[model samples]
Target: MLGVVPSSRAPNPFFWLEDTHTNTMEAIAMTIGHSTIPRMRVPALLKGNMIDVDLASLEGQWGMLCCLPRLEFCDAVFLNQFRRAVQKQGAALLGIQHPAHPFLAAHLPKAKILSIPLLTDSAQRIGRALGLSSETHLNQCQSFIFDPEGVVRNKLTHSFNWHCMTLLLGILKQCQ
Candidate 1:
């Protein structure tokens, strides 16, 4: 089991620890008002190239990480919307999907058209790390907002609708 210790820092109320004796990495359930995102690197596809992106290295700016089961036309549209919103706020936006997803190849062109980096988490490591796998829905859509210090400021999950987009935009505005 991973242990979470209270943090004195205002931005992050709690920090997590890994249990060394266990080979399996324990999932740390992130609470909107209580947890800081853990550091990790993930492979990303950008402009038709694969690269590794360090999540913790983005500590100097506001960033949003969106994880979807797969990429579709609707997902692309929402991603573009998020891209515009984040760019307006001078924040970074990233998307993640399982590499083996059935439609991933077909959606490559759409992803290439987008300016943001799209990550590939083949083993679902990122989702497991964020406790997203615990959700009832398999491969649920989720978005996370992290501040400059890498502390998660907000989290949205399940479906992505206009209302959700509006709420996310409002949160981004407030973050700024």
Candidate 2:
């Protein structure tokens, strides 16, 4: 019998799985990860207003996808700053967190994370599919930026910092 490792198995927290994969942030844009956007259209809660992000229709624009462990860690100030940065480059920023329905039901009222649009991945389907799932939780700081043609222009999966954010914004500027 061929034994297959379950993806739910915990990974070593000491190792940064996504960060160590390949340092492609400075590399030229490529089409190596060619999978088209997923077919599901999830709700994006933005400041009490709900919008549907049609992944299939975002064919000709720059976009960013972020996976965070929880919404509570996202403060209003950070959301504002992040949104301003994304807007400056004319890019769309979307986020995903676990148990989307409950999180939205409970915390959406506070309007804390109303800056960027977010999707709920209750089943971790999106996380597992995007290779952002880890032993304990989704890659909190992981992010991916895609070009108008839907090809990945930059991938940042490690810990996020000011320097890395500047680099991400730089890549977005180049995309524009």
Candidate 3:
């Protein structure tokens, strides 16, 4: 499902139909992301202010879009190791957390010191788009890999751990 299309958009598999599609065709296209979609954007910010990261604008760089329940999910040590692992593969990690959590008050200062581009999603806008919610592991952490063209190459929704991180790294390698 991750890499397969249900049907060819055109008689030739390599050619996608353009211009002149009826309303029905357009409706069908809209349902594509129920499994996989073309783009995922990450608006990076820190401490309620924007941090200037435009993940969708990245041409050839891989992006790891991580959604955390609270700031504590990205503790200083974890951020350092996570950043190093991502950077080692020539990729970037972007994180999202609840904007008004108490943990932010205590841990965001340390995150700022680490220069992590942790974003605030008090309204759960991005989280919901990625299918995250309180019912899910009390807002368990999740991550998605966006390739250079902004397609979701892979995704993970689980409790975070070093072993999972290592497995993610391997998956990223395969995507590359």
Best by TM-score: 1
- lDDT per residue for candidate 3 within 1-176, as digits (tens), equals 01223346443222221224341211011111232222345455564355555544665788676666555535646866888989999887777664345335424555555456776555666666655444434535667776776667666654565645665677678888
Q: Report how far off residue 82 is in candidate 3 (Å).
A: 1.4
TM-score of 1: 0.67
Q: lDDT tens digits, residues 1-176, model 2?
A: 11122233444222222323454232211222544456577776776667787776777888887665455535434655786888777777777654432546534544544677777666666666565545334323666777777766555554444445555577578766
**Candidate 3, position 44, lDDT:** 56
Give a tens-digit lDDT track for model 1, residues 8-37.
442442243344567432222334744556
Which stretches of candidate 2 lie above 4 Å from their native place?
1-32, 98-113, 136-140, 174-176
User: Over 4 Å off in model 1, which ranges?
Assistant: 1-33, 98-103, 134-140
Worst 10 residues of 1 by lDDT: 22-31
What's the residue-level lDDT of 24 in candidate 1? 35
Of the two candidates 1 and 2, the one with more favorable lDDT, higher being better, is 1
Give residue 90's lDDT in candidate 2 (0 to 100).
75
